[model samples]
Target chain A: PAPDSAAQGLALARNGQLTKPPGALGRLEDLAIWLAGWQGREKPQASAPQVVIFAANHGIAARGVSAFPPQVTAQMVANFRHGGAAINQLSRTFGASLGVHALDLDQPTADFTQGPAMTEAEVVSALATGWNAVDPEADLLVTGEMGIGNTTSAAAIAAALLGGNAQDWVGRGTGVDDHGLARKAETVRAGLVAHADALHDPLEVLRRLGGREIAAMTGAIARARMERVAVVLDGFICCAAALVLQRLHEGALDHCIAGHVSAEAGHGRLLAALGKDPLLALGLRLGEGSGAALALGVVQGAIACHSGMATFAEAGVSGA
Target chain B: PAPDSAAQGLALARNGQLTKPPGALGRLEDLAIWLAGWQGREKPQASAPQVVIFAANHGIAARGVSAFPPQVTAQMVANFRHGGAAINQLSRTFGASLGVHALDLDQPTADFTQGPAMTEAEVVSALATGWNAVDPEADLLVTGEMGIGNTTSAAAIAAALLGGNAQDWVGRGTGVDDHGLARKAETVRAGLVAHADALHDPLEVLRRLGGREIAAMTGAIARARMERVAVVLDGFICCAAALVLQRLHEGALDHCIAGHVSAEAGHGRLLAALGKDPLLALGLRLGEGSGAALALGVVQGAIACHSGMATFAEAGVSGA
Candidate 1:
């Protein structure tokens, strides 16, 4: 949905009269006006935020492209279930409901370097799974992912979609050593070469080089826009999914907010391509929706200031 | 008191056992370690946060340096009390206790361009008042300020302490016009010249040019460190206060975190001089503690990740 320009104008006018100097709130005022436009209300309400963590295992893990073993994906999922992961704690802190979904828990994708990561049918199924994960009742939706060697898949997809070199796209996933980074880069380069012809199609790119979690996140973002729910994109992998979604569906990112700039090498470039500014930059690289959850507070702050703060007239104060 | 190096080491060792890759959490892990050292606990808690907003009127308002009038200071203070200000909403969202203190409500300082801003006795009284504002039981302390034309005062003080020219230090406060900005710069330059001889002394510099809120914030930061409470310094004016506190008492910044790099011109230099990395960089220039209140969430997220996350052994996951 397009943002309501009328409401945005009203919000901007109100901001100017809010007893502070013009633009004193800086980017915060901009965020509030953006939220007002999306919510289609002069005073938008940010409540009942929900975060979903899509967990999957990547076939690229077998290529020694990640520092942690592929089995850690399931282990971290269990950790999330037991409320022992960073995302779990963050969700609790932000008062958001946490959902952990193993989109391909029992079925890992084929190694992208060897062939396609997932079949077209599997990609469609994963997208459906992600689409179904969006809750109708939630006002805000945040997307996070848990997958080992997924960064390698994300790099290939990003390289194909954003027209970047594999080496430039690749980063040390899970803090890999030099050898592991080299292997990861080589694997991503090989996958891009294998899928070069089909890379023009967003779904083909996902099927050929992206993991189930990325596909699911893409679906989640698309569905969030359809449902008029605000989306918060997490980090590098998540932004890669958003890139694919934005390519497939124009204006998909209108409902989305980039949560943070991840420590990953290509995350900043990905955010720039997507045309979104992150709210926080604490050098966070954790990808279990932790950054998204942390950003909920900032989003809420923007909403609170936009809707709840008194205007100059209401406060009987002079304007700038 | 110095940070507990033993606790920091223990926290670092524990971070290695977390289920994620080593350093995957990035600066969040570092923030947790810093909190551990300050809290003197391997698992530092970020509960019971408090934000104190020091409200006063700056003498430099007479120079027409600010976009907003001096009367807006007391009006915004009323807004804070009525829960209508940005800081109030942020405090409510973050669940931090809000303290609004009118340090010199009945006593506006003199124009520093012509003469000293405050008397030695008034500065001493303001410092003690700020000292008394600290809550003994609070775990985290955030300092914010509200004073019209305070930015000009902050610029003068920063130029004097950090040894920079007024052109490098001056910024448009509350979205000033180009003419107002030029006037502000000229006023700051004149004040710096007037107080050049006494600028070597930190307290004398504060007395000659700094607003009461700055003095109070300096005192609050010192007192918070003495009470072993972590301080989150908001924006440029607050950073100026921190500069004075650091100069007056060495190691005062050990308990402080730069909340965000303000849009003010000299804030980056100020943070660099203090050797602090801000948690957020949202281009916030709103005073009255809004940035610091937003940062409480980030600080809490770090603490939550540190203490609540499951170790590799505990989660039955293999290490990288």
Candidate 2:
């Protein structure tokens, strides 16, 4: 049996116990009804939505392509641990469990103990680690990422996937000026030129130019598909991972939902390639599952409207 | 004594807290710290924010200026009463109170006769009515409006206030076509020209060209200022009322904050007039306080950061 899409959910929405006008809840109503079918019930609940923020070091950061230093990754990861990052604050507000994982793509670990980025074996292990951290019966999953200059990595990965110049996908990251942006674009072009043939396979792409966190997130998407857990993808970095996962397994995209369309330069092209419409667009460039965290609320609204609002029949209102 | 706009409830953050290095939380920390001071409390709480939506009929609707009929004002008001409007759902989600007031601007109650766009007596009474509805002691006040052909009315009102050409301020209302937009702009020009001499006073301008809801919202903004409550202004119609309120009482402008800059042609100009920075700009043209309602979460985040979250010294972190 295949996982349900919004169309299937809309169908089940018609059968709900309440008899409201069709599409009464608007987007929210539609989402709620869709979720009900996904849950295989009349009402779907998201009791425990898990969000994973994969933090990685980007090779482009070494080129002074970002306003902040690459060290901000470790600094932000530590901040996340301390509940100071925007993602940490937002996840707490939404009552979603947030996990942070480090992907070693830009810089080697102290003593060079950890492999660069991650090998296929490491990616699988990391996936197992993240999956084990969540309940086997988790209701939903959200994928997010954070890395200074990761936009460059994302653009390069996107260029490799879509056969475009990295210059086409590079954008302003953390408010960099025109000169820094130019350098960032140049660095992406260089990385793509260096790793073009090597990135033909998704795993090779991750190994050649992908960050450790990107590989793990790809694995997480693959695992979430197998488990039939609903997955929401946030912004550029996670989209790169989802693109990889989609290529590795055609059906994996079925479990995925694009949370929001980011204003990042390459995000639109990536979304087009993936054939997804983001649930929201607020010009948010801050990636950290903030978009997915917001989508959870939308999903919750959908569920509530499905379960709680009085239908036209119940309210005795004439149908449209 | 005047309300202390400068009372240092919280300091503008130059450094991140959480016992971490400087600049760890990045822009979020600065945003949080800025909000803390603005709220006038060490821990400014927005648990019960207010969202006031004012609805009226526009004289320009007489020109057949909108997709829906003018009666949709009353119909949507009924929708609001029935809690079917998008803003209603959003307010419920944010735990904010939604206040709807009818301003007799478009179609006055006759024989039981009141003038279109309430008289000064009606405006004062409506102010009291709306103010009394705000719980008097709420944390924040959000003001938005709905009126068919309101873009025409709003543009006229804004032009009168800014002393600009009406056509320059006018935009398409509810997806009006090029022909409709041209006609609408012409209507604004006509209204402005007709009302210019009569609108010697801002209140008179509102009465001459504004809708019932705009007048009511103007009164509400004034009352919010008198009571020292922060008002979050939404889009052009609200901006029009805000301009009226500012003209009537310059001090009223001090109590207002911009929720988002609308994609409306004149919204930016109006916002610039008041030296206000809108918190978000997502090209939103939907009325009903949708943009303002969306911005509630950000204001809440600002308040939470101000009220919650330990200070650098409190968290034992180094300061800049």
lDDT score, candidate 1: 0.86
**Residue B26 lDDT (model 2):** 36
Q: Please, what are the lDDT tens digits per residue for candidate 2 over residues A243-269?
A: 887777676687677877777778878
lDDT of 2 by residue, B155-234 (tens): 87787777877668877656667878888777777666666576668877776777667666777777776676777788
lDDT at A192, model 1: 86
Report per-prediction Cα RMSD to one decimal: 1.5, 5.8
Off by over 4 Å in 1: none
TM-score of each: 0.97, 0.75
Looking at candidate 1 chain B, the ten consecutive residues that score lowest on lDDT are B18-27
Measured with DockQ on alpha carbons, how good is candidate 1? Answer: 0.75
